[model samples]
Target chain A: MQVTMCPERAIMEHVTSRWAVLVLQLLSNGEAWRFSELRRELEIVSEKMLTQTLRTLERDGFVHREVRPVIPPHVEYTLTPLGKGAANHLVALAQWIKANHPEVAQAQQHYDAS
Target chain B: MQVTMCPERAIMEHVTSRWAVLVLQLLSNGEAWRFSELRRELEIVSEKMLTQTLRTLERDGFVHREVRPVIPPHVEYTLTPLGKGAANHLVALAQWIKANHPEVAQAQQHYDAS
Candidate 1:
C-alpha cells in the first residue's frame, strides 16, 4: 500500500468497516442476498445504515447490486470476486476472536478491575 | 458471537477499526511504542484520534499504556497477550489485502467505468 494514496486506505476501510465485515461474511456463502435478507440477517443494522453500507460496497466493487425491473423491483447483493477474498480474511478474524474470547474476556476483566 | 450484546460488537469494532488495526499490527512486533513513534509511523492519524484510540484500546485491555515520571514523562503503549491474538488476525487481513490488491483494483476500475 502506497503511503501517499489514501484511496487504498479508503477502499480497505470499506471492506473492513464495522458493518461491511458482517455483510461480506453473509455474502461469502456465494448466494445473492436480497436487501431484506441482509436486513434480517444483521438485525441490529438500521435500514438506512444497511442501504449506505451496501451502496458503499457496491461503489467500491466488492458487492454486485442487481435490481430486477418488475412490479416491486427485486434488489439483491452478492460478493464480487474481490469481495470473496476479503470475506475470507474477515471470517478468519471472526473465528479467531471466538476461539480467543475467553482470554480476551479475562484481560478485559483484569483491565476493568485495575 | 452473540447478537444480543453490543459490547462484543463494540469491542470487535474497536480492534478492527481502521486505526486500531494498524496500531495493533505495529505493536505485534512485541516492542513498546511511544506516542511520538506511533504518530510518526501512522502519519495520517491525528493526535486526537490516536489518543482516543489508545485510551479505548487500553480500557478494553488490548493495549497497556505506561507513563514514567521524568523531566519529560515517558509514555509507551504495548499490546497485551490477548492483543497479540487480535493483531495476528488483523495483520492477516492486511496481508490478504496486499496480496490481492491487483484484483481489487481491477474491480474498482471496472465499477467506476460502469
Candidate 2:
C-alpha cells in the first residue's frame, strides 16, 4: 500500500492539504458559500491559496462551483455528493485531532522531559 | 471552524502530510517497519523526507520509534494508541478515495467534456 503511481494520491493530497481540508469542512457545514464568504470565513487563508485550493478541488470533482450572471455576478461553492464522502472522513480525522489534543500534549511534555 | 491558530492544526498538518499519510497507512497495516524497510516500501519517498516525516509523527505522539541496543542498531516504527486513532480516520479517508476513484473519474470526464 506504500508505493503509488495512482492519480488518486494526487486527489488525496488535494483533499487533505491544510487549506483544502478547511475548505471541505467549511463547505460541508450544510451551506453554499460565495467566494467572498469563503474568503471571509477562512480568515487565515490567503485569497490566492483559497482560490487555488478551490480550483484543485473543483478539478478533482469534489467541489462544485456555480456561477450566475447578475449585475455583479454571483458565484458559490459547494461539495459534490462524492465530495461529501471525502469530507466525512476528513472531518473525522480533524475531530479526532481536536478531541485528543490533551493526550498529544501530555505525550509531547513527556517526550520533552525525557 | 475555519480560522485556526491552534497548535492542533500543526499536529494535524504533520499527520496529514503526503509521506506521513503513507507511513501511517503502512504502519496501521499491523506491522512494524525498520527505516530501510520503510524506505524500500515507500519507494517514492526520499530518505530525508521519510526520516523527517517519522520524526514529526513521533513528536506528535502518533508514532513510536524503538531503537534496540544492538550492533547495527535495530530500530522499528509502529503506531502508538493515539496514533492508531489518527491512522484509523486517515485510512478511512484513503480507502474512500481508493474505492470511489471510478466515481471521481466519471466526474472528471464530465467536467472535462464541458
Candidate 3:
C-alpha cells in the first residue's frame, strides 16, 4: 500500500516506541505496577520519559492509571484488554528476537566483513 | 526484565524501525520488488533512506537482495525465511491496530476532553 502521514501510523509508532514496548511487556504479567516499581524495573529510563510514555499509553487506551487519594498518592498502572492484545504481539516479537538474535548478529558480522 | 543497551534490543529496534516495518509489510506478499517499485510504494521515503533501510534489513538477514546482471543491474528484494517470521508478527500487530484504532482514537478524545 502506498503510504502517507496518518493516525494509524502514529499509533503504531507509539505502541512500538522503545519505552512503550518495554512498558507493555512489563505490564503483560497481569499485575499492576506502581510508577516507582516500573521505574525500578526499567532502571535506565528517566522519570520524565517514563511518565510521558505511561501517559501516552493511557491516552491510547492501552493502559489504565489509578491514583489513590492518600497521604502520598498511590498510583498504579496496568494494561487494559486492548493493551494486553498489543502486548501479546510485542512479547512474541521480543521472544523471537531473544531466540534468534545470535543469527542476526552473525549475519551482521558477515555483512560487515564482506 | 530490565533492559540495558543490548544486541537483542538493537535488533528489535531495527526490526521495528519505521521504514523497516513498512518494508517488511510490503515484502510480505512474497513477490520480489525492484528498488524503484518499493520506493514508489513508500512514496515519501527518500532514495537515500530507502537504500539505508534496505541495507540494515539486509544485514540483519531479514531481506534478501539479489542483483541480476542484465542490460541494467536489476536488483530485487524479498524476505528471507527469518524475515518472514518477523513480518508475520508485525503484520498481526498492524492488523490489530487497524481494527482497534477507532477505540484508541475515542479514548484519546475522551482523555483530551478532561
Candidate 4:
C-alpha cells in the first residue's frame, strides 16, 4: 500500500534512521568536525553510508556542510538551528540509553536465554 | 571491524526501529490492542511487519502479548513498566512530530524545489 507521501514523515524517517541517529548524536557534542573526523569517531560506519547519511541530513536542513577552498579538501559539518533542536531530542534518548544500558542488557540476556 | 557486542545497543535498536517506533506510539494511548487492531490502526503496516515488530518488543520486555484461548485466535498486547518508559519517550517524539510537521513540510518543500 502507498503510504501518505508527506515531507514531514520523510524527514523524520531520515533523521531517525539507523545511521542518521548516530551521526546526529555525534554532532550533538557541540564540536564541528570534518567528514573524515566524523567517520573516525563513528568507527563502524562505512564511508559510503556516512556520506549518504550526511547528504540526507543536509537536504533536510538539519546539517550544514562547509567546504574550505584550500590545497587539500577540508569539509566540515555542523548542526543548523533546526538541526540543533532535533539533536536535543536525540541526545535525551541517547543519554537514556547510556544510563539504562544495564537494564536493557539484562532484558536481552533473558530474551536470549528463554 | 566488529562494533561492541552489547545487548543494550541491540535492544535500543529494536525499540527505536522504524516499525517499532510507530508501534510504541500507538500503544501509548493506554489501551490494550489486539494484534490486528494495531495493524488496522497503523494502516500502512503489513501483517508480517507488525508481527515481527511486536515479537521484538516482547522479547525485549517492553511489550506483553497475551493470547486468549478462544475458538479462533485472540492475542492482545500492552506495555510493561519498562515498556511504558520507552513508550513515554517515543510519545514525546511523536508529539514533537505532530506539532512541528508544518516546519518539517516547509523544509522538505524547500529541499525538493531547490
lDDT of 4 by residue, A68-93 (tens): 78889799899887787787776676
Two-chain DockQ for each candidate model: 0.46, 0.62, 0.58, 0.36
Chain B alone, TM-score, model 2: 0.91
The candidate that wins on DockQ is 2
Candidate 2 per-residue C-alpha lDDT over A1-114 given as tens digits, one digit per residue, 9 for 90 to 100: 643337778778888898887888888786888999888877778889998999878877889998978878999899989888898887787788888988988888887888
Query: Where does the lowest 10-residue lDDT sum fall in candidate 3 chain A?
Result: A1-10
Per-prediction share of native contacts kept:
0.44, 0.60, 0.59, 0.26
Task: Quote the lDDT for A53 in model 3.
Answer: 99
Q: Could you give the interface RMSD of each candidate, to one decimal?
A: 3.6, 2.1, 2.3, 5.3
lDDT of 1 by residue, A1-114 (tens): 222125566666887787898898889889888999888879888999999999888876788998888887899898988788788877777776767666667777877787
> How many clashing pairs in candidate 1?
0
- List model 2 lDDT by residue over B1-114, tens digit each: 633337777777888888988889889977788999888887778889998999888888889999978997899999998899999988888878888888888877887787
- In candidate 3, list every pair of residues with a backbone clash: none
Task: Indicate the DockQ of the complex predicted as candidate 1.
Answer: 0.46
lDDT digits (tens) for residues B1-114 of candidate 1: 222135465677888787887788888888989999988989889999999899878877789898978878999899988788778777777777777667677766877787
lDDT of 4 by residue, B1-114 (tens): 112225545665776788887788777777788988888877788889998999888877788888888979799899887787777776666666666667666766788897
TM-scores for candidates 1 onward, in order: 0.86, 0.93, 0.92, 0.87
Q: Tell me the docking grade of candidate 3.
A: medium
lDDT (Cα, tens digit) per residue for candidate 3, span A4-107: 23688888889888899889989999998999999988878999999999999999999999997887889999999989998899899989888888888888
